[model samples]
Target: MSKVIVLTGAGGVLCSTLAKALAKEGHKIAVLDLRKDAADAVANDINKEGGKAIGVAANVLKKDSLEEAKNEINNTLGTVDILVNGAGGNHPLGTTSNPHFLKEDLLNKDEGFKTFFDLDSEGIEFVFNLNFIGTLLPTQVFAKDMVGKKGCSILNISSMNAFTPLTKIPAYSGAKAAVSNFTQWLAVHFSKEGIRVNALAPGFFLTDQNRTLLTNNDGKLTARGTTIINQTPMGRFGEPEDLIGTTLWLCSEGASFVTGVVVPIDGGFSAFSGV
Candidate 1:
């Protein structure tokens, strides 16, 4: 059952692994990213491994860029049967230096120490637009191809923070929460269209996106990273490969009856209560 699948942010760690995994499973992959070289590299690897894939450079935030990508995808790989919205990330401006608000921090601010009051609108907006709008625009452009088509689905990348907001990154948490809500709304909206919509909420994976915050330059886990491992029942950071099984199942016929569900791929992170 080889189907055309478009993965936005395929240049990223998680999605790149997913693109390769899906392609290895015989799906035609459109490895799309803002970086042309990153997308091309992933696609090239897939093609070299005898998988069908094409690299396409596209901006998730720009409708015109996405439209252009859709055209290329349609012409080259055929209509998209599956779309994985993987284009969202957090920005430093959207984060606070400390998890809890402190008066001294605001009163005597140190260099590079940003508090809640220091959260810039521009940074917050960037996070929101990247996670929420990024997901919406791609669906608006690509889901049309899945309309009335059998065995079509859209998988959004969410975060465990969506269920329970983690410390510091407010904008990323809120945007991901919106993504979870949108997943439910989309599934209902497209229920009669033969298109399924769902989302995956990953807990803690050490990708380049969060590498600085999670791990120190010396290759040791930071305080925050250590805290995450302690919190996660699995006691370790998730590998990119950890998401593959659930991702494949959600995209497969086994999940035909499942839609509008935000599946937590975290290893007991969502279920645990730190006692």
Candidate 2:
């Protein structure tokens, strides 16, 4: 059966792939993104491929923006049956250059290094708001349409950092941790209302957000990327397509009883400890 799906950050590398996959499966997709052009491009592609989709400009951090988008989606595609929260990322200001802190390093700070102490409150707040609060506001706005409605589901994008903090991006780690926690909270809160809430904890995929950190300008893996690959038992980074099967199953009737689970789609990165 076809359903109306509102996907935030649909223009992004990962979510765009997911949107196209869902569209191919006959879902009416509302591709919402802060970047209007990107969103429109994805929606147009879906439409050209014989799928129904509409691009909507929306900011997950703002209630008004989300409300406006929701109105447009409802008017154009009918009430949303699935909401995918995929709008979250990290900022350089919230990252540290060194993985571990040293006391002498704090006294003799390198101009190129961004220590934890050097992290800006504004940057931390931005990451937190984008990941945690962003998910909260969209659910608050769209879950209203799902209440008392059968087969309604929500999918949040989390990260492996939510389980074990990675190096450098502390703010993103903390924020995604909150996201995982909130996913469970939402599942339990909405269980009686027939709404299923879950999250996908992706390990590492090369996306625009972390391209610089993972690859150099010449398109070779950096030290961190190499480390991730070596640590992953599968010895590879995941492709966006790698997530489609899990995503489809979760959103489809196959996962009717699955809720509040954070499924990791990393290439076994979460399992190996580099022993």
Candidate 3:
């Protein structure tokens, strides 16, 4: 069944893959991103492949930008039946240099050391706004057209950090946690309105955003990445393609009874403890 799907951050590696997959399934895609060129490139690829798509520049942080994009999408692709909130990432300033804090490091701060105390408030706020508020504002604008509309669904892109806060990237962890919480809140709030809200808490996927952190310049796994692989009982990092099946299933009628749930696609990372 072809439906109108609006995907934020479709310019990125993961969401773009999802967008292309959805388009292959006959959904009209609205690829929204802050970068017009990036969004257009994705849309153009989809169109070239005989899919319907339009790229729109949208700043999810601002309501006016989202409203404008909404109007354009409504005019072009029809009312959005599926909204995928994928416009979120962590900022370097919000990260700590070490995964854990050492007592001596507090007294003898290295030049490159970014301890939790060194975390910038502006960076924290930016991360929170990008991940949490970013999702909220888009839903505010697009979900309006979905009201009382059958088969309408929303999928938020959360992270495994949302379940258990990872080290160093505190801002991202906290913001994603809020996203998971809000997914449940919105699901219940819109239960009577026929809008289903759910979230996907992805495990470690090697996207450009975290590629540097996860791998060295020589392309070997970094210590943190090794730890992640070891923790994941499946002994592998997830590919963007790994998420497509789950994504399509969640958007399909098969998940009609499912809402307010954050599904983990982390290759058993969420299940196994170090033991």
What local lDDT does model 3 show for residue 182?
A: 97
lDDT of 2 by residue, 1-275 (tens): 99999899889999999999999999999999999999999999999999999999999999999999999999999998999999999988899878999887778656767788889899999999999999999999998999778889999999999999998899999999999999999999999988999999999999988888888999889999899989998888889999899899989988999999999998888888789
Enumerate residue pairs that collide in model 2. none
What is the total number of backbone clashes in candidate 1?
0
Candidate 1 clash pair list: none
TM-score of each: 0.98, 0.98, 0.98
Clashes of each: 0, 0, 0
Clashing pairs in 3: none
The C-alpha RMSD in Å for every predicted model, in order, reads 0.8, 1.0, 0.9
Model 1: CA > 4 A from native:
none
* lDDT against true structure, model 3: 0.95
- lDDT values of the candidates? 0.94, 0.93, 0.95
Per-residue C-alpha lDDT of model 3 across residues 7-78, encoded as one tens digit per residue: 999999999999999999999999999999999999999999999999999999999999999999999989
